[model samples]
Target: MPSADGGTTSLPPIPLALGGDDPCTAASKRTAERASWAQKSLSLPHAWKLSQGEGITVAVVGTGVSVDAPALEGRVTAVGDAGDDCVGHGTFIAGLIAAAQSKGTDFQGVAPAARVLGVRGTDERGTASVGLIAAGIRTAVDRGAQVVSVASALTTGKEELTGAVRYATKRDVLVVAPVAPDGETRPTDAPVDTYWPASAPGVLSVAGVAANGTVLRSADGAGEADLAAPGGAVVGIGPRGAGHFIAAGSSAATAFTAGAAALVRAYNPDLTAAETAKRLISSGPPTGDAARLDPYAAISVVTDGTRSPASAPEESKPLKLPVMSSTLQDRAMVVAGGMAMLVLLVAAAAVVIPRGRARGWRRP
Candidate 1:
């Protein structure tokens, strides 16, 4: 990956989770100073002038977030043992949402001034279940989180997780989640299917896209994605260290969309959770698959409160060509010009053919 200073370097990859018997991910000893391609694509510096996510609380529900992470110090609140991140995935997600800007690095969270609430959705080893993730959502709502970023995307537990999402919606809390789990977190042969909480109504389902605006993966079979954000080859801070880590998948995109939600909420304090989600979806530019998150536009664009067609995937219509009308005289002139050109070509060929044969077809 390239740093903000236009230098290239390698960094450790952060795993989304570990198997029950697998060891926890180690803390990264390397730091990447370059602004990740995601940061550049997001145009965060321009959006910062409008809103930095002040007075907002975003809950990260996953492998716990380490309170000691330098960029998130003094701004993170945890539920139970949620402050300890063994896999470093949750901390990395939290950093994407609200890590404060530090010296010597251009990398910063979408909402740098927002507060982070860490809620453990998985066990110490990062193994997650539907029940645990559902509980985490309800807990985050109880903790007064205005925006919840769910990192777990289970194929089952639709009934249970849908209820959890409804609970958050009733409280005016916006829930953002990945449409599918990261590739490494699920079985390689697993079929693409709906993930709970994200498939639930009123929840903002997000997919991941590379820096080039190409989707890294498709949304689950449930339905169309609400939005896409930078998730491929993304860089962020890890737990218990000043070093940075790289990760890719819709979970990271969900964190970014959650941060953008915070920005919208902070900027438009009167908007409801649904309204905030609508604002984000409406403001984003459609990329055929899903709307691409544009933080600056989400904050700056004024809407008439009506949903745009881009807010959801619609049945694509076939392109229709316009009806053409031409005068008979004009058509006749076009025909005459074609005939004149054809006659000139034939006359030239007739003059050249005999000369070429006489020269035994050799170049003159």
Candidate 2:
């Protein structure tokens, strides 16, 4: 997948196998305001009932899942060699996708209601070949993963990764691809120019924002960024240990948002993945370009058919998304300018701290 960064292509090694799991120190539950667009109104935190993503299975396509983590302990189902946690990348992602551990513990993920199916696609050494990722996508879809979250970059063949994305879409899977990291939107080249599946139509592409509840002004803010979520600061399992930290880029945001979607699915089991996505958007605070995703707001949309409105961007329109692939939508700029069907190669995600790797400590 060359990761769309024009970098080298090579697969890293897998993590060692773990037998089972236990509970980590859960964080203390404290009610606060539902801040992210994932929550529409100024609602109390810990107020919205978590759906537990009970019947929903969210497949995380990454290095692999940490089956023994207290959060995902008995919840992991692997089609591969039972997957491992070599880099702890999958553990962090899986944790976000479906970690509902005790309060006060630092080992919980978003949308703890959902179940996770880990498909080990990437290897250690910080490299994920295109073939491994694509295969992982196929496996996730086959395993009944309604929402497939891909955090790695297109490090090898774009065709292979895109094919895998298309396959998942054809089977009614909702795929979210994170855009590659660009150099802070250089004035010469457009910001949205880089990255793969994120540029793909059928797939939902995500970008990051800061913790102050403000989207990154440096972010291209092109039409591709459907909705922005807090990516700058978070608490999750990293290589060395855990603390209040920030994970950058659309990769982190995608996992967080995917967890919200899982919660929505848990709340309502019948909605199609697309419908679920739309419902989620309808429920969250609105941004001119598109409605940012909000878990709390979505609950209202489901239960009351009304959600809070979003703040308007300078000239952002009240996005009227349709049902077909956003690719074919006349108004939906799925792929801007010259990247109609470009696919990225194999590579590790740039602009990101793999949570455990040596070189991933960048924070701005």
Considering every candidate listed, which one attains the maximal lDDT? 1
Provide the overall lDDT of each model, using Cα atoms, as 2-decimal numbers: 0.85, 0.57
- TM-score for each predicted model, relative to the true structure: 0.81, 0.64
Model 1 segments more than 4 A misplaced: 1-7, 19-23, 184-190, 218-222, 305-364
lDDT of 2 at 191: 38
lDDT, model 1, position 161: 97
Q: For each candidate, C-alpha RMSD in Å?
A: 9.8, 24.0
Error of 1 at 343 (Å): 51
Q: Give the per-residue lDDT of model 1 (tens digit) for 1-364.
A: 3332234757878877777777767677777777888888889999999999999999999999999999999999999999989899999999999988777777899999999999999988888889899999999999999999999778789899999999999999999999877763444466656777788888898888776777665443434678889877888999976888888888999999999999999999999998888888878888766778999999999755445322543354567987656787689789999999999999999999999899799765
